[model samples]
Target: MTGSGARSVYIASAEGDTGKSTVALGVLELLAATGGRVGVFRPISRSEAGERDYILDLLLQFCSVDIPYEECIGVTYDEVHADPDAAIGEIVARYHAVAEHCDNVLVVGSDYTDVASPSELSYNARIAANLSSPIILVVKALDRDPAEVKAVADVLMADIKSSHASTVGIVANRCRPHRRTDVLDALRDTGVQAWALPEEPLLTAPTMAELREALDATLYSGDETLLDREALDVMVGGMTAEHILERLGESMVVIAPADRSDVLLALVNANSAAGFPQLAGIILNGGLRPHPMIDGLVRGLRPTLPILNCEHGTFETARIASHTRGRMATGSVRKIDAALTLMEQNVSQAELVGQLDLHAPEVMTPQMFEYQLLAQAKSDVQHIVLPEGGDDRILRATDRLLRRGVAKLTLLGNPDSVRRRASELGIDLADVDVIDPTESELIDEFADAYTELRKHKGMTRDRAVQVVRDESYFGTMMLHTGRVDGMVSGAVHTTAQTIRPAFEIIKTVPGVSTVSSVFFMCLADKVLAYGDCAVVPDPTAEELADIAISSAKTAEVFGIEPRVALLSYSTGGSGSGKDVEKVQQATELVRERADDLRVEGPIQYDAAVEPSVAATKMPDSDVAGRATVLIFPDLNTGNNTYKAVQRSAGAIAIGPVLQGLNKPMNDLSRGALVSDIVNTVAITAIQAQNLKNGK
Candidate 1:
């Protein structure tokens, strides 16, 4: 959890037979194969003869270390048992041990009965929160019903949201080998990250070899070649005979023709009843098909099942039935292929955590911001500052944001002026607090604090107090003294005026040496983050390193993992210069300092994004060609590149979302749109929640 580019991943499930451990093992193996130092954690287990140990043993065989099974999962018992509150604490502690030994730890879920027992459905969520790791859900595709799977997924998502845990995605294991498309389609409907991992053919057909080898050459009337293969979802049609009826239980047999009238009558009777088998239907062949009696039966039973007919003899139908088994047998190779495809689309653990934060209960809907024209929604600490205090648009927006729960309203102007402007514009500010800057209750308080903070700069309290009289200073002071959680005011003012106060009063958070900004480059289905565009003119290696970390954190806030690529003219070893060296050094510094972050750089845009290009230039580098967070060495590069990507590539660029501040503080471009304001507000509120959560 605390090593270089190595973060802990927690896999869990809300239901039984979800295949949590198996999927977790496969993910650990996949990441480890990519040169990641991985560790496994099974938070709780109930085993009789240490079967869990065997599973963990298999995991260690693929990992870089040989940790004990106990180390793999923090807690284990002989039988199924779990204590809700204690399980989370114990699991986190256990994962901490494993995480200490490796760069990342993968926590696997136990049985659903165990995960859901003791309390209800809080087990897996609690574990993810306790460990602060992203969660991967394992879904089993045994029943071949997408709706069933979706129901399970819905419960899992709700639980994850409720527990405030970071859930990365989901893997559907033990899928029918050839039904990947169907299962994948089903998973997509859930609106959650899901993959159908293949079940091995050999595993599915454990008895195939033995069955083929043991079969007597003359046991059946059908050709042996006809029985060579089988389908998984097969149907067997048998002519209703006394011998077949006795042995019908051996297969999914549908008896027919023995009594067209009786069978039709029975079918009609069963058709009207509920909970009957969804049969492949009955076949009446040989020209002795259903008569009027059968016709009546067929018509009546049509609602329940379908019926098919042919001119072929009973022998042909029997032959086809025998061959159905081969077609119906599920294979494992297809499952493996699907797993690989899923692995290709797999999002990193960090991305999932960020999504959870975005969807937290405290967040406000974008519509709320749009209706009111407020840029952000804040919960618990709602009071905000409006720099353009007398504007009617600000008042209306304030009311909207307030009603929609964006934040508490604080207008920075005279009550009379704001009210008169609202009346002129038919806007209502009845519930909004109009803080006339000249008569503000906190103006004197801010003046004193301002003087104290700037006292050493040769400025007297009078000058400092005079400077503090500005609206920006009042807003900045409110943020500093906890009167407000954040401030969004740059529309009617220059960037300098909006940011200067924050730089002077709010200051950067500790351990973050610089304040930087990034742009959220959004597309229809994806987003890429560009950083160092607003601050740090010509950052040094150390400063660039800080930019990468800060950018990744910012990307996380917007529901993306920061796979940072420190951009330069060349990738890998193509070009050489101090600028390039700075980028390379900055990348290394980021890796060294933030072991938990994933970043690679000193690479060109192509190499950082194109898998083939990256593979050719940096075959062994993990971040190359898969970078999500692009770190620019200087403000010029960051700004120009992001603008190009936005305009030429048709990417919808959002932000200039300021990062590394003590609280949420954003700068709006003069040309920012209403939609942009709404989104900025969402991002800010999400950031506020993250800061509140201390991440």
Candidate 2:
């Protein structure tokens, strides 16, 4: 669990059909439960279609695993078979690409589908060893002798050790209930940590989708939601309807001829009744369809049974269903739950998770930052107000945020206009609260509150009422009155228009001399905080120091270890000028006020980012080239530099996240994308959380 870089574990099997996916799922769940942003990779995938790997796709879809489906695969089996050497190179490269951004990665080894090559097992070992990942070997043990289990473990351990892949543990899957203890003992005697998983019939039975795939069947009528149902047993409807009905077991798939409306009707009626067994599906053999009258009757009943028509006869269809294995579909919650429950109950999750080295590195990637951001925002849901409700980007982001359940949103605009725009854009705002600032029932009360807060600034009741008509002031007042936890604006308004009300009403936090902002520069490899980018055009030395301190705190809040760098044209007094002297003075002020902070100042950008350049420029300073929070001397430099990096390096600049605020309020660019709006909203929600926790 403690490593210098991203830690990875590879799950491999010596032979095929070992149910390694179950182990992978359990591992993913354990890692996720422990607050790990876990990623998955399949080194050599067996899927021929241009689709995602089934197990990896399931994890991404259902487990809240923050990884792309394409990122989960390395290479296809055909590509590997064509050129093994090139395939290995590509696989290693892709695996590292995924592993670099994750705290922990679950590398799934190849499923030995191609038996033409006898070196498939060795190939898996080679891939695992090359990646420097620890291996967890899974072996099938159902109905096998203890001696055979031991032999498999011994051979696999030898091969893995020979290939220089460390074996952290071994799992004997599908072992019989009575033989589990003996098999586990045998595995442990081989000097490896071991666990035995009993054979689960529900896991092995074919699902509706798998049956359809195997028989190339067509679905005539059934609920689409029932397609994930598992066919636990197969029954042939060759006998009379009453006899067949008596023979039907729980979750049975009935295979009958197309003309046997009596059998089909009996099954359907039984399914609809209370005490009878529920059929998983009905396979109509011989390309059969019910009679016109029976079809109309079935349609009228609208039973929830999934009906499939196949060309094969009753016995052949039954045989095919029996041989076919169940597959985990994208939305199959039952099987996923079963897998997780099975592993959690059987496997030593604490020990297994502890064995994984998952220490994150000093630098954070964009994906990691986004994942952490979402997780942080969801930790405590907060209500956020968006003043630019008429903008498509804001509306779209509102929809996404609601869908993800990250925050509660209140859009400020004319209610009718907001609804019309949302409808035109095909966005759903049913859950969002849309308010008209002028027509609100609380206008007079809000005017009174605003007058009380701004009386010293020469505000009157009439003027306060007029000012409250503006959506920005109204939204900011909502924050001040604790109606909403935060506010995000500036998409369709100037920065002054968006932030002026906040500056007047919300004000700055206690002990904060200046209100500043920081942009989270999401570079390709790591995230850096660039401060004073969108606010504070000019500041004195003391104010600059405050910005540095505030930016460092922002970095810390977002999981970046802040090493402050007071950036300038000079490096440690190498040059003399007004700008350089001001930067040096600010650095000294930071040292005086925040002595505990690690800071270096009057450093050039090259020295602050390039280690080799720092070695020649300022070698003795800890933050010379490893600064995670960069404090610019002026707004001109900060804004231009952030933009340059954003355009040239393709970095995602995720702010001007305002700092030093009594309550959380953030601004966005006029050209902000929907994703940018979503991220900004999440950031504001997290800032609100900080205030709630009294951080």
Candidate 3:
């Protein structure tokens, strides 16, 4: 359990067919009932045909989770089998990607399949340990004796305990009704929480689709939707029609030769009878098709029953279908509801949820950070204006922003040109507000307001009118007069062009002197904040301290804990230079002015991030080697370093998100992608939210 307010648990089984999916579904339902956002993850899936994982798909369909299907699966079992070393890292990375946005995630481990290695248990343990997730192991106790089941449980418990993952509880699935009490008593002294789930035949019955796949059968006639109907058992129609009618059971798939028209007719009649059990479907073996008259008669029924033809003989098809386990289909409400109820009755929901440890230290991975940004932006809708609306990337991002309901957009451009470009891109702009700054009706009003604000610098209204003609200046005026909540530009313009208007109009926030910017450096594993990267080329010691404070505050807004690291060429007192002294002075000033902040001074790049270097360089400093916000000494170093890391390491750099502004005004790189624009727009919206709440 962590105090970070995010929680996750890993569910694993000792072997294949242990009813793990049932426990996973039950847990997901329990968590969702609390009204918190829940997510599901399959770290190692067995889906080889490029089809979606059945468990993952089922959970997404039934649960209230809002993420895409592909986002829930980490990697396939074959990928891990081919290269175990590299696959582990990919699994953890992908899990973090999906887990960041969820309040709680139920991680389903791999099913012990034949294609997987014998060391699968070890692999699952390693995965659980890496994720720091508590384990809820599910063990099968159907066929084995009570003592044998106890032995298996003991070994699994020992292995999990040795792996350093806390075993929260164990669910003994499919235990025989007669021996369930004995099995529970045998494992009572294992020193761990355990539940014995009795075998429920209905919960394990295969659906008609599973039978068809297992027998490689062809559907001769039936509605495709009825394929999901559960078959309680397989009955062979080897006797006369009258004899087969007497043996028919509820939800049974009758297996016989295709030429057995009498048996087929009798089964259909039995399904129609109110007193008899409903026939799930019929499978004709020996590669045989029914007579045309019989098929016509069956299809003539008001509600057609499923009929499948297979090439195998009756015994072979029956053998295959018997081995197939029932799986809950995506929309099978009856089966899904039954499975959830079964688990809810047997498993201890309160105990399992209590051990999830929701407060664990929340590590803000890149994916989680981006998801949080979008989620925060949507919480309170904000209107933002884009000055460079002529750019295709801006227009495309506008489409996505509006489609997702993240923010309301107003594009500042020539309306005709903007409409023409949008048409060429096949984007709809009906919901977006397009404004041509030169022809707008509010031009005079905006010009008058701008002239009043800048009248001390220049005493002419003509100059103000011309300045307002520029889109950047006009957009900034909209923010100044509260016409828009935020502004984002610079896609096809310079940073100065975008920020100059903001500086002249909105200025800096109160008690703040220097205006600075920070780029959210999204590395593969974590997200870091790089400050003073785009603005403030050179600054005095006082200006540097202000930038550090502002950068730290900016990081907090985006869910990052700020440990400010003042980067310099020298580490502590190791070297003497004018540049190094400036950083040292700035670090001291930040500490004295904001005593609550964790500040470290004159630290080298390696010392600021690498723990080993910090131990030798500055062991007593808290921010050394663990910095989340890096404050650069000058623009030359900050800009070059950010680009180098971004290009060399393939890191995603978001912004020059401007800080210390009275209102939110951000700048973008000239070669920004559509996704970059989308992210910047979302960031601006969130910043607007903060200002609206008076943060």
Tell me, by lDDT, which candidate is best: 2
Candidate 1: residue 288 lDDT (0-100)? 55
Per-residue lDDT for 1-695 in model 3, tens only? 32233577889987888888888887777665443456788888767685767778887753434688888888887788789878888988888887777777888998876445566776788888877778888889989998888898889888887877778887888899888888888877777888888887767888888888888888887666667667888888999999998998767889999999998888877766655666788899989788998878877874457888899988898888888888766755445656666665676657765666653234444555665677689789999999999987898788667655679999999987786556433356888889999888888998899989988898478877888989999999999999999999999989889988988999999989899999999775578999999899998999999999999999999878999999998999998989999999999999999999998989999999999999999999888989999999999999999999999987778898999999999999898987788899999999999988887
| Model 1 lDDT, full chain set | 0.61
Query: TM-score for model 1?
Result: 0.47
- Badly placed stretches (over 4 Å) of model 1 are 1-381, 392-396
Instruction: List the candidate numbers ranked by lDDT, top first.
Output: 2, 3, 1
Alpha carbon lDDT at 66, candidate 2:
52
What's the candidate order when arranged by decreasing TM-score? 2, 3, 1
Task: State the lDDT of candidate 2 residue by residue for 1-695, as single tens digits.
Answer: 22325677889997777888888887766655454456778888777786656777776642323567777788888787788889889988888787766777778888777752466767888888888888989999976988899998888888888877788899999999889999888887887678888887777778888899999998978876566668889988899999997888867888999899998888888876655766788999998689999999999998768899999987788889889988765655455556765686689866786666665445445655775686689779999999888887787788667756689999999887787556433345778899999889878989999999989989999999989989999999999999999999999988999889988999987778799999999875678999999889997898899899999988888888999999988899789989899999999999998899999999999999899999999989999888889999999999999999999987878998999889999988888887788899999999999889887
Q: Estimate each model's TM-score.
A: 0.47, 0.59, 0.54
| lDDT tens readout by residue for model 1, 157-235 | 7778788876567777667667765777777776666667655332232122223332211211112222222122223
Which 10 residues in a row give candidate 2 its minimum summed lDDT?
58-67
Pairwise lDDT winner, candidates 1 and 2: 2
